[model samples]
Target: MTYKQEQLSEEKVFKDPVHRYVHVRDRVIWDLIATPEFQRLRRIKQLGTTNLTFHGAEHSRFNHSLGVYEIVRRIISVFEDRPHWNKEERLLCLCAALLHDLGHGPFSHSFEKVFKLDHEIFTQKIITGDTEINRVLEKVEKGFSQKVADVIAKTYQDKLVVSLISSQIDADRMDYLIRDAYFTGVSYGHFDMERIMRVMRPMEDQVVIKSTGMHAVEDYIMSRYQMYWQVYFHPVTRSAEVILSKILHRAKDLFEADDFTFKLEPTHFLSFFRGDVRLEEYLKLDESIVYYYFQAWQDEDDVILKDLCERFMNRRLFKYVEFNPNLQMKDWMELYTLFQQADINPEYYLVVDSSSDLPYDFYRPGEEEERLPIHLLMPDRSLKELSRHSDIVEAISGKKRTDHKLYFPKDRIEALTDQSLKKKIITILYGQGEVEDVR
Candidate 1:
């Protein structure tokens, strides 16, 4: 029998913390899940360095990936009964959802930022290249893997299928919001996901929510906004990411230097440092391997690499104060020189991190990340765009909110022998009399 025609004799169910039961009936999905490539996700954290802040956010990408698959499965099951839905695209949606984050490497954001790589590109490679995922997809049908990859790449002909995985309010966002909130033990991501699923309707080109489900959709948007600020963009997590990026940058600089000695060589990172990372070399890295290197770098000859590694692994993270480069350029420059005068490499020790979010947006005619706006199917059979009708969603729609923070090691300044310099730094950070240590 063709792999596409295969099914388990009995459905396999995974007990998930968020979705409860991730039911798998397709033999292809079961086989794909057990493959080494997919299983590697077990070692990658869903929220890298978030565990340091929320102690409970120790969940792996494998956990969130399965939850995404389950959400797609449930959504597709309902879509199967709809008139406009193409039942042939069912498995493809499931595969795309399950593997959308397949190529996320260890500490994804920082690693990608350093390496100048996109996880989406790697995801396409994993699905369409000479790998286990590709082989399983091939057995299903000729070029089946390409179809799945196209869905993830948002280049498929069937816009409805593409919407299932990549649209404004699709399975990927739905699952991650709830899953991250669950792991991080925060209540911000809770929206009526089940009700939203019930209200979803397949359209000629995309999925739309029932007008009656406006409140639920509003809640989902709000949840996303809240989670972005309170959880995903948490200052502490960004501080850790800053250190991680600096460590990679420091290691690469030392590797390129004329006379640099190292106690522990970064075997997996050499290809990356050379700007020629192969897929095999990339796959070999996970958080565990990263931690191993951090432990070794602590004893390295380069003090900067050793310090950044120790800060990342030992929870001695840099602290931050709010700063806007637009209005506080002088403050930043002052702090920059003060840190240098204190014998700290301001480049590694001082960082300005910015995060922005647009809660919901209508489709722009020609924008870069051109997101298709969410449509609500009216009871009278008319279609209306979301923000136009929902006050809560409209208030934040197309309004890009940005946050900026300046990260530095306050501990070093506090420990300075020159109390006057320390006081100057503190005064510059806060105000004349405002001085309190932030860890």
Candidate 2:
């Protein structure tokens, strides 16, 4: 089948909070979103368990997909009549943006960790395989679906289209940074997006902000830096993630041992436990279904399963404290023993959480996962690498920062019937003082 862009009789608009209105002019994009595969995003929260910490973060990836499409639409508007910006690439870029996250399942991060599934691969399949998305893409032209897939895969021959959706600073990142910040009510992600869009110019191989707009680029980099530390890497979110991961591990262990009796048998999880997940089964799983199981599993006889479900649903997040990996191995071992003595399963109750990110990186030749360093197009038509010209960017480039925490249930330990064991655990975990709130 060939792919052709078909216009809808009446253009549809999604009332978006960030972009105001996400307009869909093409029928293909509309049908793609309406497909059950894409609609599943409505059930998958954009920030995962971050909603546990930030109640307002209840927005879904469905919101983000629209936001990214709107951003790309704006960028494409800028690219019109510009050098190296091919107008023909418009539909391809839009398709890639809309379908980029079609593969993500419910509670994406935790599911990915437990099942070892890569959303990217599933995304490719949805676009190129036998599905409504593929059928829509094939309507454009033969091989058009592949072209869109190529853009998403970052292998499209057109560098401009590839860069528009998947660069150091692309539409996806631009949307999520601002959208996540808005929903999470964090100030760190407020950047001049309009200014960035105005300055963006299509280059031979990438997009570059004009020299005069260097300040806007600096602001964007800084916004990302602050957002990472302040929101994306928040410890409370990680604590929930740690608990979620342990729940899956313990459930899988119990299923294998045949010691667990689930009110609702783990049908959806069987393939994952066997290390083989069909796309259909994967697509059927969403946050609502998971929450339904969590509700049911709260009554399971297995202590760990029941406890974890209650913890996740009620937002009884694990308490965390600063940990230094190099110096804390012995302490971690001791904590594990203390957890055993306290009758808390060390495997499910004790966890180490670490998060690291580079705010920005300078071009280092031949580095794997090398980001296309931002450039400023000067008045004289010369290109300059961003860090060379921006003092703030230069100050932060290549600096990777990491945070680590040791997580446990503080309330449970505090309520233990065995006073002696509780005291020993508390002393070993926090060293004579009550555990401080981790926020």
Each candidate structure's count of clashing pairs = 0, 10
lDDT, candidate 2, at 289: 81
The TM-score leader among the candidates is 1
Candidate 2 local Cα displacement, residue 272, angstroms: 1.2
The lDDT of each candidate is 0.89, 0.85
**Candidate 2 minimal-lDDT segment of 10 residues:** 430-439
Candidate 2: the clashing residue pairs are 2-138, 2-141, 2-142, 3-138, 3-139, 3-140, 3-141, 4-139, 4-140, 4-141
Model 1 residue 103 lDDT?
Answer: 94
Tens-digit lDDT string for candidate 1 (326-438): 98888888888988889988999888999998888999988889989999999898999999899898899999999888888878877999888888888888752233233
Candidate 1: where are CA atoms >4 Å away? Answer: 432-439
lDDT of 2 by residue, 1-439 (tens): 2234467779899898888899988877887888877888899999888887888999999899988988998889988998888888888888899888888887787779787888888888888887877887887888988998888888889887888888778898899999999999988898899989998999888998899999988988899999888887888889889988888887788888855567789888888888888777877788888888888888888888999989988888888777887987887898788789878988888888889999898778888887888889999999999999988999999999998888899888888999888877777677623454744
